[model samples]
Structures are given as C-alpha cells and as structure tokens.
Target: MDNIGKRIKHIRKINNMIQTEFAGLIGIGQGTLSEIEQGKLKPSIDTLYELSKHFQIDLNWLVMGAFECMNLKEYEYELLRKTRELDLDCQNEVAEFIEFK
Candidate 1:
C-alpha cells in the first residue's frame, strides 16, 4: 500500500464493510470516510485508535502497513528462540532473574 488510506481500505474490505457501514462504525460520515480512503484526507490518531480497537488490528499495521516486528537486533531473536527451549520452571527462573537484575 502506498499510504495509510490504502491500508485502511484494505482492512475495511477484509472486514467485509462498505464505506457507509464502516463510516457508521467509526462515527464518521460516509463522505469523510470516502475522502479518507481516497487519500484526500488523513485520519487523526483518535480515529486510528478506534479502528485498531474495533477491528482487533495492530495499530502499527494500520498506520504503517506492517506490524512493527520486535525491535530486537539480530541476536535477540535467536536468543529468545533458544530460551524457549528451556523447561518451564527454568524459563520462569530465568525470567525472574532477568527482572530482578
């Protein structure tokens, strides 16, 4: 998607809501909704929060077209993957120690 408008449109279609219904749900006029989807208008942060909550969408995905993956550097993902292999009790202990530190 080129911008937030396209992402919003994609989400609306995927949720099976037309402009009128989606606008009603989001508490905006259909004309305004159309303008937003057409890129003539940008949605405010409050509108974005409403959309995210109503649709169970990740806000990062809505605003940016992709989930903000874990901000961890390369080694972190590998470390976490290995950490998951530990027994549950051990994992909890490790987690507790990490928090304590």
Candidate 2:
C-alpha cells in the first residue's frame, strides 16, 4: 500500500479483524480507526508504535512502504533480535550471507 491508512486497513483485513475489534486491540476508538483508514485523520506516533508492537509490523513498511509487511515467525523475530545486537560490520556480513545464500 502506498499510504499508511491503506496499509493499516490491509493489516486489519489480512488478520480478519473488524474496525471495532482492531481498534480495541490498539487502544483506539472505532470511529478514530475509521477516520484513519479513510485517510481523514493521521494516526499518532503512539498509535503507530502500538500497531507495530501488537502486530509485529515493520514500521518502515507501515510509514513509507520501504519493505514488505513483515509478520515474522518466532524464530525469525529472534534471529532479527540477535542480528541487531551485532556490530555494524558483523550485521553487514550476516546480511551478505543471507543475500548470497
């Protein structure tokens, strides 16, 4: 999706959640969620962060479509966490290995 609203809506739909249910999960009102999905209102940073944390969404993709919507498995999430602990050079090496493989 090109816009944050669309992306949010896509996430909800893909997860089989209605506005009320999804809004409740993210601590938002159904009306506010509707407004956001309609692009009539922008989501606050707190809302974005909640969405990212709750859904394991990639903020980059949610904000700018910079990456795929990454719903990582548990092991994948652990791998990412471990990779992030590495120094920049080691991170680059890991990335290169992944890319090459």
* C-alpha TM-score for every candidate: 0.63, 0.66
Model 2, residue pairs in steric clash: none
Per-residue lDDT of candidate 1, residues 56-85 (tens digit): 666765776553254554355335645766
Residue 5 of model 2, lDDT score: 94
Which residue ranges in model 2 land beyond 4 Å of their true spot?
A: 68-101
Q: How does candidate 2 fare on TM-score?
A: 0.66
**What overall lDDT goes with each candidate model?**
0.76, 0.83
Positional deviation of 87 in candidate 1, in angstroms?
25
Q: In candidate 1, which residue pairs clash? A: none
lDDT of 2 by residue, 1-101 (tens): 56889989987986799999999999999999999999999999999999988877778868876554455553564477458668899999999999999
* Best by the TM-score measure: 2
Considering summed lDDT, which 10 consecutive residues are worst modelled in model 1? 66-75
